[model samples]
Structure formats: C-alpha cells, structure tokens
Target: MSGAPERRTRGRTSPSRLRALDAYLLHCERPLLERQDGPWGEAAFLDVGFGEHPWTTLESARRFRALNPSLRVIGVEADPGRASAAASHEEERTHFRQGGFGWAREAGQPVRLIRAMNILRQYRAEEAGAAHEELGQALLPGGLLVEGSTDGPGGITVAYLLRRGAEGLAREALLFHTDFHQGFAPRLFRDWLPVDWRRRMVPGSALHAFFAAWTAAWAEARAQGADSPADSFHEGARRLSQAWPGVSAEPWLWENGYLRWQPPTEVPRPQGL
Candidate 1:
C-alpha cells in the first residue's frame, strides 16, 4: 500500500535513503498481490541476491500474504551482513538466508517465481550462463526467474524474465524504463504499465526473451565466421564450457548476454561479446 511515492537517492547510506528502498518494495509488491489473489498454500517466491533491497522483497511478500495468506517468500543474499539485517527486520511471511544463489539446494516445495535483480553484474561478463545454471538448478520445472539491474532510484532499470526447459526459454518480459531513477532519469519511464522509450538497449532487455532465436543468431554468426557479437559469444562461451564441463548454457544465453553487452566488444575477452 506504500512505496507508490518514489523518493530514492544515492550517496552514503542513511536512514532516509533506506526509506526509499522500503517504499520501492511496497510499490512493486502491489501488483504482485493482485497477481496472486488466492491462498498461498500452493505458491511461494524466492528473492535472490537482494542486498539492502531486501525491504522490497519483504514488502512484496507481505503484499502476497495479504492476498494469499499461505504464500511463502524467501529472501536470500550472498552477503552475511546484509542477510542478517534483513532477517532481523523482516515482516510476516518472509524468510532470510545468507548464501550465494548457486548454493541453493533442492526445494522441498516448488517456487512460482524468483526475482534475481542485479545479481549477475558482479560476475565476469562471460559467466552469465553459469550464473543462470547455478540458479537454474534450483528452479521448479515451470518457474520464472527475472533478472535485471536498476539504480538506487526505483525507475531506471532493465529486467529479463527467464524460464526453464531444455527446448527453449520463455521471456515473460524484457522491460526498460528510466523514470525509476528518482531524481535522476525522471523522464525515463514517465508513462504507463509497459513503458516504451523510443530508444533501446544493446539487445534491449528482451535480448534473452527468446532463447532459440538468440542462440541461432550466435550459431549463424559462428557459421559465417563473421566478427559479430554472436560469433564472439558463441565461441567464447564454448571455450569456457570446454574448460569447465557441464557449465554451458543453451547457445541462446551466451548470445543473449553477448547482445546485452553495451558495446558488444565490452563483454569478457573470452566471450568476445
């Protein structure tokens, strides 16, 4: 019910600074409750790599419970300090754990959704797939994993929705909006639900939306022996996988990350993305 009013700022972390995050979480949680308008006995969520942003996940969980009281939400983080803080201050229907997402064991109960924002940015660019693989290993058969990065302000952000299956990936949404930047990108996403800025990111947030198509782009580039992002990612990732068995992604992910890179050349040297 709160967080609808955005007031995010960046700098040294302060009490007021944290309030913006708390509010932002409430904002994101509103729709989630509507999406789950039923009992939670059959559904749950996993919010991975949430840093100080745990408040948002907690707010989302609270909203979900208000709608479906039985729903469960787990807030996980790699940093023990942040994890402890969030665990101590969590609201109802929330659980907190300290560990890397890769360390997630099998779930006793399946998850409906997993929000992994800004999680992979910390890794080497080429390791995106391995990052996915680490999280993928924990995903329920049909669960959706959303990935993205956003500034301290709530608005300026990009997110990709990923699904599991050997055959392909279903990207629920690859969206970008700048208004969430608070005082920053105020004009970014000043529109409606699905904000559409005239400009697009490298591959746009939707680069990973369709795996088969993305990977084919890579394979095609490799076949042509062209010097494109596709060829670079395809080859680079191949080498990485060969060196570390069972860690490769479906060709699509590498290409997706390749395209997601800013200059394409900016991707890790190995991927050449």
Candidate 2:
C-alpha cells in the first residue's frame, strides 16, 4: 500500500446492489472461494470501500461462508464514521475497518480475495493500476482481486479479474455481465467498464476493436433471428468467441448473461491509460 492518502469518493449504495457479482464469484470462482490450505486457512475476504452501509459486505459474507464456513470477512471504508457505524453488524468472523487500500497490510491480515466494486469512479484512470497494486499487496499467492464498476441498481457490471501470481497481480481476464434489466447491447458495457478502460475505447485501440466486433456479432445474431436480449447475447457471444481468441465458450456463462474473455496473455491495457 502506498503511504499517500486516498481521496474520498461517493458512498452511494443500495441493498443487493452487488448480488449478481456475488453469485458470479460463487459460481465461476469456486476454487478460489473454496480453497482452505496454508495461508488460506487464515485469509480473509476483504470488501474495499463498502460505501455508507455494510449491506453488500454482509450479504457476501453469508453467501461465501456457505463455501468456507470459517472464512473471515472484513468491510473497509475510508470514511471513519461509516466504518465505525458498520461495526454494529460485526460478528465473530466479520469486521469493519477504517482504512484505505493498505488496510490489510497495516493490520497484518492475509487476504484471499478483495472486491473493490464501484470505488474508483472518482479517481483518475491512470491511478487505477497503482490502486490495484496497493490493494493486491496483501493477497496470498493465487488470491484474486476483482475490481470494477456496476450500474446504479447493479444490473450490469464489468470487472478485471486479476490473479496474484509469483510475479505479481496478473491481468488475467475481463468479466462482463448484464441481467438485461434495461435490455442488452455490446455498448451497454462501455459506461460500466473498469475505471481505466471507461474512456479508452476510442478507434484504433484494442478495446474499441473488441467492442466493434461484439456489436457486429450482435447485429448478425439479431439478423439471424435472435430475438430476446438474452438470446442475442448468447448468439452474439458464440459468434464473437469463434472470431476472437480466448473468449470463453462455457455454456453457463452465455446462459446467465456473463462473458469472460481471458486472452492467452494478459488482457490488453488500452494505451494511454
């Protein structure tokens, strides 16, 4: 964690705002959630910048505990008052801490997973990488950092699934999800991309090209009779996977409005970020 202070960001949040993300992790990141050997035995699941309330953090604690009963859960807030107020909900295995990205390291807590959803919207895009590094410093090897943004009600989300490795946090994959509450389109994710990528989708860039291809695939799917949003997404994703390397063909993902693109190498960082 850097010694520099973290700027305070908006704390708006609603109940169940991140439920879809929780379900996605429980289903797709089972190995990470279930592992309990070595450092994992004492590792905690950290929810960074948990907003004005700890509802999401509490919900995730219940959901993840089903897989690892002894798992410790910590909800961290940069705001001292919010963090202190959250303490009322703490139990034997849950805690509310007032700190920034360096909270875990400062407290000597080993982390298995970190969720920093919707916390970077106010920061400069160039600062996201450093933030990621600071947040990942306390993770045990193989731990995961899920950093991203979701819509107001959380029907849509896009996150970076970074994995801690021998080298450091590897930009492993990009996860896109939409429940179709407002209907679906490849463009729907542009506004919800992780902070670093939200403004990097210009022409000539990989991110732009990726979205262009997806939009084309979606149109083609619709032209071929994919009617509903879900159907269009599934068909378009299937086509995109065929043309794009590393697009996951996993049936469950398409069926559930999730798309995981894990390139053979690191997911490309849009230049100039």
Candidate 3:
C-alpha cells in the first residue's frame, strides 16, 4: 500500500447507491468509456472504496460494458477483509483488490476512469488535494477521475469531474444531480459536495457565489409559476444557465434533474489545494 496513511471509514453502502452517478457518466463520458485506441485499449475502470459489498462496482460494470464489452473493472477496498470477501464476485473481466488512493500506480495499471465516491468524507478537508493527485497518477491522458458523495438512497449527488490531460488532472467541472426525492433546492447539494468544496461554500468564495446565483434563479422560477419540485428545478436550471457563464443549457440535463457547471475556467480550488 506504499505506506500511505490508511483511511478508516464506515463500510455502509447499499445496492445501486451510485446508479445515478453511473448513468451520468454513461451519458456524458461515453467517448471516454468507449474509446479503445492506444492506452485506452488496455485501461481499466477502478472503483475505489466500494464499501462492504461490490454491488455498486458490479452495477457500474454492467452499465459501462454496454458501450465497451471488453472493459475491465476492479473494485478496491481499504479494509483487507472486505477486499477478500469481495473476491468471490470477480470474473474474467472484473477483480477485487485491497488498496487505497495510490493502488493503481503501485499495481502498474493504466486507468481510463477512477470513481472514488463517498471515500474522502472522513478525511480532513486539507488532505483532499494530495488524495486527488495520488488518485489521478495512473490515469491515461484524457481519462477521468470522479470523486464525490451521494445521499444514502442515491437521490442526490455532487461530484468533481477531473480530467487527465497533457498538463495533468484538470478540475474540469462540478456535476450536480438530484432525483428531487427531498424536493428541489440549491442548498440540498451543500452537504453532498466533495470534501474540498464542502468547507469552501462560505461568504466571498466562488462556490458560495455560485450557490447564491442558483438560489436566486430558483426563486425567480418559483415566482414565474414553476410550482412543483420538478418544474422549479427545470426552470431554475434554465435561468441559471442563461445567467451563469458556463452552466450547461441542455434540455436533457434540466428535464432529468441534472446540472453540469463547467466554468470557462477550471473549478476553483480551495486555497490550500
């Protein structure tokens, strides 16, 4: 494990806890998932901290393989016992391993994607930068690293989509999604944001400004007769996109409870990061 500091986290996870995230990726990252040239031809999708069971990992494998049947999937758990127990679910195209942030680099695996959901919640906010760098070290150029948190039933999720490029891992965008299970409100995602962004949503911060704009848009939409949760969300997102520089205006995203905010510049990093 490279003597890296170990992570001690709860192994509480349920089946399909990350299905929304998988679907988002399948829709937006189709090219990355389906490409089979050069390094991508042998790259693997690494699911880190897949918890007590490999259900989410297995679920993603099925969804992603629909695009590329030859894809390889590996589930990584920090707990040795949990890792061993998950081995029973392995197949010719899937595997389980005991490791942490640096696993892919140490194992000499080329990676096309890395999903580290709900893994860094227990870590101090200041530690996220190093963790991100470590996790992206093995990604092939143009590959992606999705790290974030989702609500228990997977009704809400906020993730960082970092893409590896010639310059390194770029903080490409902040992806927000919700099923409106708790009704629609911009603040519903505050608690589910990635660890680095969770503490940065205070006054004078870019994230705070972003949320403020969203709140305003929501209120405006409500005033315009968008009454239901779904209606408010869809209309608010449409207004936010018009007011915001880089918010996506795609009808599919708004209608389906998703908002992808990719600023013209990279997602602003918290001071320490």
lDDT values of the candidates? 0.47, 0.91, 0.91
Residue-level lDDT for 4 in candidate 2: 38
Clashing pairs in 2: none
- Cα RMSD of predicted structure 1: 14.5
The regions of model 3 sitting more than 4 angstroms off are 1-4
Clashes of each: 11, 0, 0
Ranking the candidates on TM-score from highest down gives: 2, 3, 1
Candidate 1 per-residue lDDT over residues 27-138, each given as its tens digit: 4334443344333244567877666646667655655565557667888776677778777766566788776654444445456667776555444444554455566555
Q: Candidate 2: where is the Cα deviation over 4 Å? A: 1-4
Candidate 1's displacement at residue 234, Å, is: 35
Give the clashing residue pairs of candidate 3, or none: none
lDDT of 3 by residue, 135-176 (tens): 999999999999999989999999999999999999999999
